[model samples]
Target: MTAQAARHHAEGRLAEAVTAYTDALRLDRRNPALLSGFGLVLRDLGQIDGAATCFEAAFALDPGCVDAADSLGTLRAGQGRFAEAEACHRAALVHCADRAPFWNNLANALSRQGRAAAALAAWRRAVLLDPALPEALSNLGGGLCDAERLDEAERTHRRALRLMPDEPQANNNFGHALQARLRHAEAARWFRRALALDPGYAAALCNLGLAVQRLGDGTLAERLYGRALRATPDLPLARFNRGLLRLERGDLAEGWAGYGWRFASGQAGGTRPPRLPAWRGEDLAGKRLLVWGEQGVGDTILFSSLCGEAIARARSVVIETDRRLVPLFARSFPAALVRPHGPGAAAVPDCDLHTPIGSLARVFRRDLSAFPGPAGGWLVPDPARVALWRERVATLGPGLRVGIGWRSALVTESRRAAYSRLDQWGALFAVPGVVFVTLQHGACEAERVAAEDLFGVAIHRWDDLDLTDDFDGTAALMANLDLVIAPATAVGELAAALGVPVWRFGGRDWTQLGTAVRPWFPAQRLFQPQGGEDTPGVLRRMAGQLDSRLI
Candidate 1:
């Protein structure tokens, strides 16, 4: 009967195997081999609890049942119980210390727990134990990629692919390694290979969408996200990426709904435990609500536009924002208590509900109609400092004061194209009767000097003002400017928020909320390189506009 049950399972007759195993187990309840075999049948049938019970019984019946323990450990790993899975795998490894699969299992659990160094060592040991093990090789390649040993990762992944040519996961993982190296086109091909192997593979579909997104096809990327969601409805990554697409295109309705999936998709901002339940668009009537800042400084400023709406609805509001923005925010929202966030955050009064600043859009800015503002922007700058800058700017002679930020301080590989080089701003600088001032943050003295030498136009910079840390000072200075020209970065956002006329550029800003201008700031105008137009061409066009419109 046991042999028949094993034969049924081996032939892929899972239902028949389950029945055979039940009949065999009824005959010999104390038999560890029978119990262990029964556990496999149950596990394959999706009866996880029953399978666990069978494995436990088998191990109890015979303490030497390493297979039963290993099976149980795999079940634990599948349930997202990594620590328990690690414990179970370790127990199995004690008796079967030489087993490559046991080490691989242990390594997988450790990897999930974010113990990268230990996981790498375990994967190496597993590969050393059995150099031909495809799973170990694939996992080791991923570890190498995480450690940024791209060359080693590519070699390891190539070997894994050679060993398991038909494995979709191996192909997908190799594509991930390529994507990490910014080889999106090559990565897309590997993702396609993975998709060809398994049409319903959700992960590969999401990865393919990311590659397409990097190639600048937001429409196709969104469609791929839809496909991935269709493949796996609960996939957080697809949902999160789709949300970003919708938001960027000014589809606030669906975008905000999808944006909430960011935390679940393993995007940052979930590090600190919540003191209160997440506020999911619930009515704040009489409820003390906390709106916390997230993402970057620009994001915090942009999202704070919705804080006014939050204040109107909630009984009281406590805003926790970037430390530098505290003074500016405190003056802007005088009704609410404003505090700086991050380590050593000041004592915030208890709140009934809490939400990240980004999440406020899902409730307040559901549509363009929800974005009605007082105009001139929401944030307020210090009147005294504004007067101080006004006097200082008067000394620069009779010309339109234009603050310029050429690039962001936090430019990553993906964001490289979003910002322009200092030389690209030469066309705008060459415009007559324009006093170009440096609002460019971080260290850019070389670029400033080079710009002056290249274009023979001086970009006036303040030696006293700290552009990076002093937001209140920056706000005051920006308030005195006649106009601000920059990318879709902090300077643009801040100037616009201060009600200063800003000519902002870069790409399709989703913050426009599907309009000709940014709804969050009525004082701003957007510019982008149309068709095949490059950065300098766009800047030249902007100069023409400045001459006719403002000069």
Candidate 2:
């Protein structure tokens, strides 16, 4: 009977195996091996409760049943009960301490529980027990990468590849390590290798699409995303990437629809409020609406423009935003109550419907024509602060006062390559009657000194204001400037929102939909490097434009 049950299980007939195993268990109810085999069959048949009972009985009958303990641990881990899984794995390891599979499973559970150091130790033990375990080596490589030991991770991944050259997971993980190091071209090759091993691998396809996108092939990346979605229809990462690609191409309708998947994809921060229903373009004649901010400060400022439209429909509105922007948002939207996000803000005020600030685009700005004009500036800076800044600016001797921001707060390699270098501002500095004031926040003393020494010009700095933490003060300072010349940072966004003239420098094909200007901010001018020209060339062109304007 046991042989027949084993045959059924081996043949992949889970239901037949369960029936035969039950008959065999009835004959020898107290046999630990029989009970463990029955538990395995039950687990395969999807009877989780029955399988757990059989495993527990088998363990009670004979605590030495290592297979029963290992199986139970795997089941618990799959069910997200990592602590119970760890206990089961530890029991199995007590009997077979040298077992590679037992140590590997223990490592997986520990890693899922966010115990990275312990997980690394367990993984190392597994590899030491069996040096040929490719999966363990791959996981150890991933752990090393997470610890920022990039060189060791690369070597470990190479070892795994040598052992199992055609392993899809190892290939994909190796590609990820390479991608983290910004070797996109090499990463794409490994991703392709993974796809070759298993063509239906949705994760590899999505990763390859990102690699190609970074390599400046948006069209191909879009096609890969489409393939990934077709293979795995509910993949959030693929959907989110598709949405970004569509938006970049100016397909607003499809773009906004895909953009709504950001929260589900975990690309956007914060979970949706549990009790409040999401707003879906319904008429809110007498209901209170909550509009909460998501993403960065620049994104919040950009999306705040839609509040006026929301105000026109809802009877009352409440805005929850970053702490720094509370004063500015409250004064700008006096009709609505404004609060900073924190502990008490989690329990939202009485509201009929709630929506993320970015989600408002789907309801209001469905197309390019739906955007408001240059007169649509909704942010109102404090008049007193504006007056104070105006008086301070009067002491700088009457030239064209320009606020310059050349760096972003979150500096990445891609941003560094895209933004204008401090030395590149030589041409702009040489422009007569143009006085440059530093609007950039953070540790700029080194860069400022270098720029001044290199360009032989003084870039004025104000020591009294905390530009990064004080949005209202920043807005007031922006209000007093004649023009702002900056990269596509938050400063540019703030200046454009305040109706100040801004020249935003960017990389090739960065301006959305190939347009020379962004429809969201009509007061801002978009400048891209022309004819293989670098940052210096772009700055020279901007200087020439300023010269013509001054003349």
Candidate 3:
């Protein structure tokens, strides 16, 4: 009967195998191998609790039972108990050190626990044990992509596809490697192939949507995202992608809800958010609120617009922000205690409630009506420093002081298409009676030199003011500028927040929230690309405006 049950299990007859195993187990209840065999059949039949019980019984009878340990570990992983899964896999490996699949399973559990480097090492060990292992190769490819070793990932994924030709997950993972390399069209083809293999594959659907979105079909992208969510309603990547699309398309109510999935999608960075009692727009009449900054420096500034509103409701407010912005925030919100924040900022004591700065938007800026603010700006610069900067700029001769930033310092391949060369802005640089000054915060000396050498036009910047570290000084300097022209970078955000007339170009970000004008900044003059218009082309149009209006 045991032999017949093993044969049935091997032949994929799970129902018959279960019945045979039951009969065999009645005679030999303490047999570890029989119990493990029954567990495998129960697992195949989707009776997870029954399988776990059988496996636990088998392992208890014989701790060296490899099959029982491995099966239980896999089941734990399926249940999202990754740490316990890791321990089980480790125990199996101790007795069966040569098993490649055991290493692969262990790698998966490590990866889920956010130990990327350790997972990659484990996957490498699995591949070393059995080079033909398709799953390990596929997972290794993903790890390489995460580490930004694109060339290695591309090669690894191609090999994985060769081994797993009809596997949807392998194909989808390969497409991710291609997508990371900026090969969107090719990635879309692989994603389509994955969908062909498994039409209801939610991951492939979401990946295809992203690839098509990059190809400039927002409508198709949105439809694909919807389809993916319909297949798996809790798909994080789909929800996050759909949220960005909805925000850009002007659908706020659903957009913010979807955007909240960013933390799960790994787009917002960090493995864990600050551990504290989350503030959900509660009445804080006598409560202290601790709001920590997330995202970039510019984002902190943009969201700081709501600090005053938060302070009005709370008895006391604690604004934890980038160290550079500490002085500026302290001066602006004198009523609040502003502190310099780093990692593990949630340990602040005496706070009644906590919230990430970005979450403030869902409550305050639920509609377009919440965007408009004060005349001067939400952030107030030091009066003495502003007057000093005004005097310094007055020495440069009589003309409008215009601050310009051509591009972001941290431009990756995905962002390269949106940015233009600094020389492409010669038309704006040539605008008569405007003193072009560099508002770029980092590594602009090289670009400024090259631009001056190429066009005989200099974009002047003061040496004393460290734009990167001295936010107070940068704020004061920006307050003196007549207008600021830049891409959608931190410079543009700062200038706009300071209430200077800022022309922000090359923007297709979700932060626009579907407004022609920046509802966040009353002084912003948008120069976003019109249909088929590149940023350089948009800058040329701004040049024309510069001559016609400002000049």
Indicate which candidate wins on TM-score.
Answer: 3
Give me candidate 2's TM-score against the actual structure: 0.83
Q: Which pairs clash (backbone N, Cα, C closer than 3 Å) in model 2?
A: none
Model 1 CA deviation exceeding 4 Å by range: 1-159, 177-186, 210-223, 248-250, 268-273, 342-349, 391-398, 443-446, 449-457, 547-551
Per-residue accuracy of model 2 over 303-390 as CA lDDT, tens digit each: 8988989988999999988999999999999999899876588575578889999989888977778877667367999999999998
In candidate 2, how many Å is residue 353 off? 2.3
Give the alpha-carbon lDDT of every model. Answer: 0.87, 0.86, 0.87
TM-scores for every candidate against the unseen true structure = 0.79, 0.83, 0.85
Q: Report the poorest 10 consecutive residues by lDDT, candidate 2.
A: 508-517
Superposed Cα deviation of residue 530, candidate 1 (Å):
1.4
Clashing pairs in 1: none
lDDT of 1 by residue, 1-551 (tens): 99999999999999999899888878888999888898998898899999999988988888789889889989999998989889888888888888999999999999888799999999999999999999999999999987778899999999999999999999999999999888999999999999999999999999999899878898889889999999999899899888878887888889988888877786645234346788989788999988888878888888888898889999999888888999999999998989877655534447888889888889888888887764787899999998999888889998888999989997754466788899887678777889988999988899999989998998898899999998899998998888999997899889988888888877775676667777887667788879988788888899899888664
What tens digits encode model 3's per-residue C-alpha lDDT throughout 1-551? 98999999999988899899999889999999999999999999899999999998998899889879988999999998999899989999988999999999999999988899999999999999999999999999998898778899999999999998999999999999999888999999999999999999999999999999888899999999999999999999999999888888888878888888877887885334556688988788999999888778888899999999999999999989888889889998999999978665556576888888888888788888777654767788999999999898888886778888877777765667656788798888788888888888788788889998987886788899998889899889999889998877888888888888888888667887887666788667788778888777898899999998763
Q: Which stretches of candidate 3 lie over 4 Å from their true place?
A: 1-125, 181-183, 214-217, 342-344, 391-398, 462-464
